[model samples]
Target: MTVHNYKLTVTWSGNRGTGTSGYRDYERSHVISADGKPSIPGSSDPAFRGDATRWNPEELLLASASACHKLWYLHLCADAGIVVTAYEDHAQGTMNGDRFERIVLRPRVTIAAGDRALAMRLHHQAHAQCYIAKSVNFPIDCEPSIE
Candidate 1:
């Protein structure tokens, strides 16, 4: 058996005290170099009790799913000799049932200068083979387009 390793570091400082007294900022300005992805939120500010700049771990649950799927899609495209000049995903998710159970990711994909059928084929391959979609418990769907 083998296991992969991952690590994360978080730092923050502000008016120390958990109350409606001052401000607390949780900004994620730095990221790991190996993947070149911003793993944390860039700006964090706690102006009130209901509004906080620090990212709640729960929010990432959905973002991770989308990001994972996007990366997988890109890799699959490359392997199939598909050139994706531009790609973007506007993912949205909802939480309910006290369990944060519903997560929906809609990825709008764009492939540059390729046959429509070929692009469609690659998109299909990307979804069928995404590892995160296989590993997580969520209803994942996509609308891949080329423009």
Candidate 2:
């Protein structure tokens, strides 16, 4: 077993700064994000409170699963002697409800100019071996559109 970790930090400053007027304003930041760019992604929504355009942990977690799965697909294809010409994945995710909502990541993986049978097998191998997909409790589904 292996472990990976990252350090994240966020900060904010602006109108509604630490006040009870519902003006709740501040800048979000991250310590090791975008190479030390301390600006967390945030929406203009009054609910967001105010911040940058950095994806939150939940979204990032989903992305990690997608990325990891893609890499695993490539690895499995290589091991299986499948020559992949190209690959693409449109990964999307959403929260169920509440601040701690359950999230789901759906990845549609596409392959180009490869053996159909081998690609199909690699697709399954990728999903079965991806660490992030296996780790997350949420529903991480992959639609392999191998071509």
Candidate 3:
């Protein structure tokens, strides 16, 4: 078996002079960074008093799943001689209170040339091999369309 380790730093930057003095005293803002990579501004969901402009944890989770599946799908397509010209996913995640209920990944793919049926089937393989999707407890659904 092979093992891969990842590390990153998350620093809170929401102290408004007085530290966590009260529930709404501090901003729900922070920075996520790793070596040789650009920092990502992070915050809680806007409903939880987070900055609407920054990337929230919920959104990041959804993005991770989408990106992981996309990478896997692209690799599978390449190996199968499927020429993908464009790919986009409009993914959505539903949260019940504090827990995520499910995530729906709607991927629209444009292929220059390939077997349409095989292209669609690759989504299943991609989802099965997605590390993020496998790690998450909630269900991840893939709704793929080939063009």
| Per-model lDDT | 0.60, 0.61, 0.98
lDDT of 1 by residue, 1-147 (tens): 679897666543333455325333322232222355565542222322322554544556667777887787788778767778877777766656445565565666666654657766665666667766677676667766666
* Clash tally for model 3: 0
Please say which candidate is ahead in TM-score: 2 or 3: 3
Q: TM per model? A: 0.64, 0.66, 0.98
Model 2 local distance difference test score: 0.61
Q: Pick the candidate with the highest TM-score.
A: 3
Model 1 vs. true fold: TM: 0.64
Taking the tens digit of each residue's C-alpha lDDT, what string does model 2 give over 4-85? 7766554333434564454433344332335555545533323454344545565567667778987898888777767677
Candidate 3 TM-score to native: 0.98
lDDT tens per residue, model 3, 1-147 = 799999999999999999999999999999999999999999999999999999999999999999999999999999999999999999999999899999999999999988999999999999999999989899999999999
Query: Which regions of candidate 2 deviate over 4 angstroms?
Result: 2-23, 31-47, 50-52, 99-114
- Work out how many backbone clashes candidate 2 has: 11
Instruction: Sort the predicted structures by lDDT, highest score first.
Output: 3, 2, 1
Global CA lDDT of candidate 3, please? Answer: 0.98
Off by over 4 Å in 1: 10-15, 18-52
